[model samples]
Target: MNRYMWIIVALSISPLSAIALSPEEKGLEIAKEMNRRDDGFGDFTATLEMTLKNKQGEESVRVVRNRTLEVPEDGDKSLIIFENPKVVKGTAFLSFTHKVENDDQWLFLPALKRVKRISSSNKSGSFMGSEFAYEDITSQEVEKYSYRWLRDEDYEGKPAYVVELDPVDPKSGYTRQLVWYDQKEYIPLKVDYYDRKNDLLKTLRYEGYRQYAEKHWRADRMTMINHQTGKETLLNWKEYRFKTGLSDSDFNKNSLKRAR
Candidate 1:
């Protein structure tokens, strides 16, 4: 009966062993799992309606089209073109994100007939007079932040994992972000961004997530609210088409001029 007792003891300890991971390790594991679940969409195209609301409740809207290409060895590449609004029409932005290095970005102005490079120092600034900063528009790689698992809690009636992400980039505008990841899908439901002064700056919420290709999840709408300025940006995405056979040639700086 000694062997039987040993087996029982082993089973009891296994559960405890699984729960003994340090906060950092557990946080990293969660981030990696989330990244793994989203690994294989070759490319996608979508239409976006961006609404900017000021503190006085005045609103302005812009129509944009977005194309993204996945890079297995590095971060993704994306190009965004403005489609509507007489003022911003024919404007385009291109970004090449890297896992370890600063991202390369450029903006093409149709009126000016020039392409302006976006410097790393200016990434934290506003994007197109919206609440979203330029850096916030880039794909967030798993390696870009250090994470700590805060706790498990209920968020909006669903069980969620609360995790704190400290930006690895020194130039980041946020000191830390508290993220609420849906426990079931491993997708982010909400995030609270703290500014460099460690004060609450903005809150972003994802809504109406729908699965694509039976494996990938995308949010239909995202709202970002700036507490400091009382300004908000709403991104409404539609017509998501995945695996559109996009290539690197479609995401270069030169392509920005031809985006329209």
Candidate 2:
């Protein structure tokens, strides 16, 4: 009698444990969960030092300040101001990312004294000659790509889920990206970018992750390596401050020109 009751109990729970989601459904679920975890940080400001290195190992450094406002329904807005390296000082880049539309971006060239709009066609171009593309700097909305759960693997001694994402934009420079997202944090620790030709193009590594606001997980350093060019770019982030009461007016194209 005891064995029969145990079998019935096991049968009841078996159905729940055996439930499985399709690959597409599983991928979308993971992406949505990651996005949810990162949401609710109203705004943030940080200082970044960008280091560009050439094939011959020559290095150039530039300092910039970044401010971003979170927009839950769509995407985030950001303003980036070049602060040092007198040649490019006071130059700013403003971006408004959308959930299902092309992102709006503007570049303020202090030398030319003009704020120029960045067309969608140029979104794949290098950002400030760094390895990072203009689109790469924008907030990555879940709607921008179609995802598939690839597999589970160990990355840097951490258990991670491998996800493949294909960009929805026809003109995107990358054909697809494979990301290793840490299971615990749901944040990507490494990303492999492939060119339009379906050739390996670049690899981006996220490092030095630290939690902010006791909930938000942020990487303090990121490195991008261009495989074809043998060039690299490193970004070091510092002084992250959140919820500074930023508004839409602070992210407009006009604000780019006024950015100090």
Angstrom error of the Cα, residue 39, model 1: value is 0.4
What lDDT does candidate 1 reach at residue 109? 88
For model 2, the stretches where C-alpha displacement exceeds 4 angstroms are 1-18, 111-113
lDDT against the true structure, each candidate: 0.90, 0.89
Error of 2 at 157 (Å): 1.1
lDDT of 2 by residue, 142-249 (tens): 998899998999998999989999899988899999999999999989999999899999999999999988888889999999999999999999999888899888
Model 1, residue pairs in steric clash = none
- Give lDDT: candidate 1, residue 136: 83
Q: Model 2 — TM-score against the truth?
A: 0.90
Clashing pairs in 2: none
Model 2: how far residue 145 lies from native, Å? 0.5
lDDT of 2 at 235: 96
Candidate 1 residue runs with Cα over 4 Å from true position: 1-19
